[model samples]
Target: MRRSLRLLAACTIVALVCCGCGTIAVRKTSNVLDYLYPEGSPAIPARDVTLTLPLRVGVAFAPGGTATRRGASDWVNATAMGGEVTEAQKLALLERIAEAFRDRDYIASVDPIPSLYLAPGGSFDNLDQLAQAMGLNVVVLLSYDQAQFNETTNWSITYWTLVGAYVVKGENNQTQTFVDAAVYDIPSRALLFRTAGSDVRGGRSTPVESPEAFRAESAKSFEEAIDDLIRNLADGLKVFGEEATTGRVRGQGTPEIEVKAAPGYSGVAKFENGRYSGALGPVELGLVGLLVVAGLARRRSA
Candidate 1:
């Protein structure tokens, strides 16, 4: 019994070292620009615009020789696991993105751009063509890069301090995913918004693992990161465009409507017909003074 207890204790220590062995660090890099609408462009009231999420999701690697090669290798390995992204996963990803916009009421409706309309690489250069094909007023272009690394350390297990094998190895795997999104006005070919988000996850695995494990872990990391990315993206949208409130629609660059009140004008302002038809004259000025006095009186009485 004593000998067994000692062996169990050693195994526990080994497990701890194998599980919590390595150090991992991650950094985020991004550039976000405020939303820009050109002069004289129509105010895209949320309820009046239709947005599309193309069926094809883009995958891009970081530029530079080594990083690009590494990214390509990682993508190849990721795809080899479970043999490519299944139809269900693809649909889920698309629906998730659409739902993000729908929850915010950012557009009148969300539609999926057919895969046939997308190019082989899923680049955004053909966005104008896609918008024309789908009749979409707004197009959201999505692209992402994923980088993964594995570091191995030397460790061995012994049997009763006697003859033992040193073939087993422990590994530390770290993954980082960076996402970029841009919103475009199809008709004008204007880029209305641009933003990015990144996430990193690290863990330890034994036996050097399989591609399947890597795929599953990477997918989980991506899902978590995507939620935050969508949230940030939505927040950024609120800054650029107007959001509808309970009783009013909020927006910038909206055309002002002229208010004309006849003789019995009781609300807010009073109008007098004269040379200055749309101008606020003495009667309108008097109405404003009356309102201010009445408001002050009511407050005092209360």
Candidate 2:
């Protein structure tokens, strides 16, 4: 009977705290969520409508990674955790891109089971198998480059769940905050699409070692990274998406993309001398700055 009273008190405390705190948390998350990643469907070329039919757009995800063990680069490896990513964040990004193409009205509905690229000797190794199953003519494979760093986390102790442990505190710590991103074509095993997109990394302190701290840290980390990725993805999809589709169709020779940058960012191109000159636009850089600031502020508050 005594043990039950303690349990009830702990629950009551947590519930009260959450009632006061949860609303702000939810609001910040909802706003931040939009910036996580920004992607959209590619636009079909205006000149080539007569010769071809609308193609199916498929997303093929590959194994992801972070820069360091401190969780400073969490963005790099968040997606592959299978169940770790939020439905809203993941589906929102995919939908934006899918809708981009759907707006073209030439594209059919986006496929549900998007393809995935596996490590060597994994279950789904064959490209042909994926292409066949997806019934896809075009596929987008996104990649990540470590963007942010920092792993020092904050802790607010709360009651513990054990029989005697009381008032366990929650800690916010950082581990990996990497920023890596790219898009590729699945069929022909060719690199049809790519993006320098948004590369912003949040520096988390250290991951909180306790279970509660770890859970909160993980969820918040995932949320922040997902938000940044979505914003940048959206920008890239809008700009290069259509052009990438165009290039895949008829662009056989080396090409260069002329891009106007926002302001101070070093707008670097990949290929030179009439090779593959990929142009990154203003929208991506702007979004990167916005998310980076938000992540830093959140880390400080936590």
lDDT of 2 by residue, 37-74 (tens): 22342322222211123446665343322222223221
Model-by-model lDDT, in order? Answer: 0.47, 0.39
Instruction: Please report the TM-score between candidate 1 and the true structure.
Output: 0.49
Task: Output the number of the lDDT-best candidate.
Answer: 1
Worst 10 residues of 1 by lDDT: 59-68
Summarize candidate 1's per-residue lDDT along 1-302 as a digit string, tens digits. Answer: 99999999998787555533433322222211212222344554433322232212221121111122222121123333333333354446556677765533224446654334554433334554665555565666555556666544443233123232222334456778776777655544445556666678876554324344556766776676667677777666654433322112224542222222334434322111112346778999999999999999999999
Question: In order, how many clashes per candidate?
Answer: 0, 67
- TM per candidate: 0.49, 0.41
Instruction: List candidate 2 stretches off by more than 4 Å.
Output: 1-53, 64-106, 112-125, 143-172, 179-181, 196-209, 241-302
Question: Where does candidate 1 stray beyond 4 Å?
Answer: 1-90, 114-116, 120-125, 156-169, 242-302
